[model samples]
Target chain A: MGTGYSIRRVERQDYEGVLQALSALTTVGSVSRTQFEETVDHWNHVKVSSEPEILQYHPYVVLHGEEVAATGMLFIERKLIHGCGLVGHIEDIAVSLHHQGKQLGRALIDHLTNLGLRHCYKVILDCDERNVRFYEKCGYSRAGVEMQRR
Target chain B: MGTGYSIRRVERQDYEGVLQALSALTTVGSVSRTQFEETVDHWNHVKVSSEPEILQYHPYVVLHGEEVAATGMLFIERKLIHGCGLVGHIEDIAVSLHHQGKQLGRALIDHLTNLGLRHCYKVILDCDERNVRFYEKCGYSRAGVEMQRR
Candidate 1:
């Protein structure tokens, strides 16, 4: 929370800035300008397409002066069965390689968790094996198993 | 495919019918007429509030004559890193208790999987330990673990 960087919702101008931050993450490749614009449009509050109601998607970034330092996406889900009516799912969290150790990732996660608590019963995220301890240090305890395909 | 039942997208009138079916899955209290109408409105076309583009949400139900037999919701997600551009996530699947032991569950999963394949690289769903074998029978294999909080 004490980071010099400011965290805010992503904007059209932040597309390239976010991409620069995303480059530090593994497996992501070059995104065309058009594709990037489309992504920005989707994340923007403006309605371009009719998306399902269950996913209330929000993407945010941390800016240090003019440079993007970290980014994450969050989705609010409505649960039918659980007594908890709303919950959050987080995906695609990344910090610029240069910003790794400065508590930037921790700051970003904390910010998201706070936001989720405002509307969601609780927030959840999935990480690879390497990041388990990192999340545990952030006050998250391991629960269940993660399964995926493709 | 020939169960004398037709799978179709949910419509406004299907609200009560679907809610009746959903009641079997959990303890959902009765919904006011206005709430039911609002839910149908949300599911019918897409945007209630603006949402991101990655997920194309669709909720479907199986109709046997005038009765609703089963239901499921599917989401198509676009992946950035994987060569696979899109994937599907299935949730909120339910079958009427009276309809159990029939292949309705399998039929619904297969139907959604086919829909996912049309636009996604693969389809995925998470199940409780008890239902793991059921999904395995539907051609999904255990690939990883699922973790969550709240």
Candidate 2:
């Protein structure tokens, strides 16, 4: 009725804040802050690099009132095969805990898909069997059989 | 002289092979291919996702005579802080048991590092303290203390 939230790209400075916020998010349930921070750090390194080649393939984040509310990647593959030799990955979609149910997650994913379309290729993402419904809601189908040997 | 050794980026199809090769590099020496394949599937999902607010990074491998000899990530990050902000990471660096010589590891790190320097604000990675020399030789200096809550 009053103001609809906005979706934006995440920036570099948001790393620590997001990590801290995730620590808080997990505090609501599962992991401890220390454990969560490690995951966040691992994610950070994967996203940002001291050297840059594949960096150009990555994209930015979205901010709601100056706070990062959602994030994802517009992943691209330069190698041949898998649809005209170029493909996109829909990666690391996260929504702020307090911001759940606002459709911010949907909007963020839609934005990523549109970006992929702009590049003219397929946009793909894999989810835990637990998240199949959430991704289905986001317009992604069960594309293939993916297994993790961890 | 015989055919001189060389360096190059990994082909996409080469991944599944390396995924299987990881068993030989495990801390305990080897793991079951069945167990190894599962983790590879998981990491594949992680690397392929790049939705709205998140960054997704991946690994690159070095080849010697059609075999993977060394591996690391071609990481990237956005505007990040040095002491505070963090960017990308280079992870899972392993040299094949049979190809330890020929400077394959050094060549792989050099290639991936250059890729990161071009795009992101910083490139960072973590390894067990025992790997200090391995990373140091690759030009990584250790300073900050890293603790994981997980």
Candidate 3:
């Protein structure tokens, strides 16, 4: 809600900027511009498909002036339960260190969660224990244990 | 594997059985047989699309003498990071009470996990604290906190 700050779906041109923002969250190794564009094109194609809205991916970025300051992704998954309802999986939220404290992260999360709630029965996410309080403040609560195998 | 027991992709005819298995996880309201068939067709259509393997959904079930004994789902999500790699989300793993203690759950999990690893960089899931040990025994470890808003 700040002046000169806006949140929108990520574009192909925002590849580098989006990756830069995501780097604040985890290691994002070198990605060629072509690869990024291809991935963007893939997302676009799926968005236009007539298939059911299962597996829809929406990656968003917050821009402060002309710089990408925050990024997050929401993946909508269709489930057989709940009358074949959609479930949103929010992931990879990151805010650039330089843009921290501007409430950009909170705004971006609100934007994504709102988008999710519009189309999903529930929005869910996984975060480190240290960030539980942050997400809890974002209107989420501890629901279950996260398990992984790499 | 027990005699007459086998795991494979869920078919349209397995709708009632699949929902019955999922009921052990949560409340699954009544879903019409036609709705289930339509959803199965949509999934099959997406699986055969030329689009990048971003939103592939695979639901599998273990059958014992033609009765669905266990069920699970693996959703592969395409990520911009990790070289645009795929991340597998395993969900709704359930076994009928009559079929419990026969290692059917473990076998179904292994089958789904193996399918995930073949196409994804990592496989992730969420389970209740009571089920942590079970998933751990199936080769998963606690990774993060699961948060949700319904």
Better-scoring candidate (lDDT), 2 or 3: 3
Could you give candidate 1's per-residue lDDT for residues A28-110 as a string of tens digits? 56676666666566545422224332336677898888788898877665544343256666777888886777788888888
lDDT of 3 by residue, A7-117 (tens): 887889998798898888887877889878876766655541245343377888898887999998887777788887778999989999888888887897788899889
The lDDT of model 2 is: 0.50
Report the poorest 10 consecutive residues by lDDT, candidate 1 chain A.
A46-55
User: Model 2's A-chain: what TM-score?
Assistant: 0.66
Q: Residue B86 CA error for candidate 1 (Å)?
A: 4.1
Error of 1 at A100 (Å): 1.5
> Model 3, which residues run further than 4 Å from truth?
A47-55, B47-55
Runs with alpha carbons beyond 4 Å of true place in candidate 1:
A46-55, A78-85, A129-133, A136-149, B47-55, B77-86
Model with the higher DockQ, candidate 1 or 2? 1
Instruction: Give per-model CA RMSD.
Output: 4.3, 14.2, 2.2
Model 1 Cα displacement at B105 (Å)? 1.5
DockQ of 2: 0.04
Model 1: fraction of native contacts = 0.30
Each model's DockQ score: 0.33, 0.04, 0.78
Model 3 docking grade: medium
For model 1, residues B9-56, the per-residue Cα lDDT tens digits are 777677667777777776656566565555555545443223333336
Question: Candidate 2 on A1-150: residue-level lDDT in tens?
Answer: 015455544444565445444443332234444543443444444421122323324544556667766555555543222222234555456666766677766777778777765553466665556777776776676544321110
Chain A TM-score of model 3 comes to 0.92
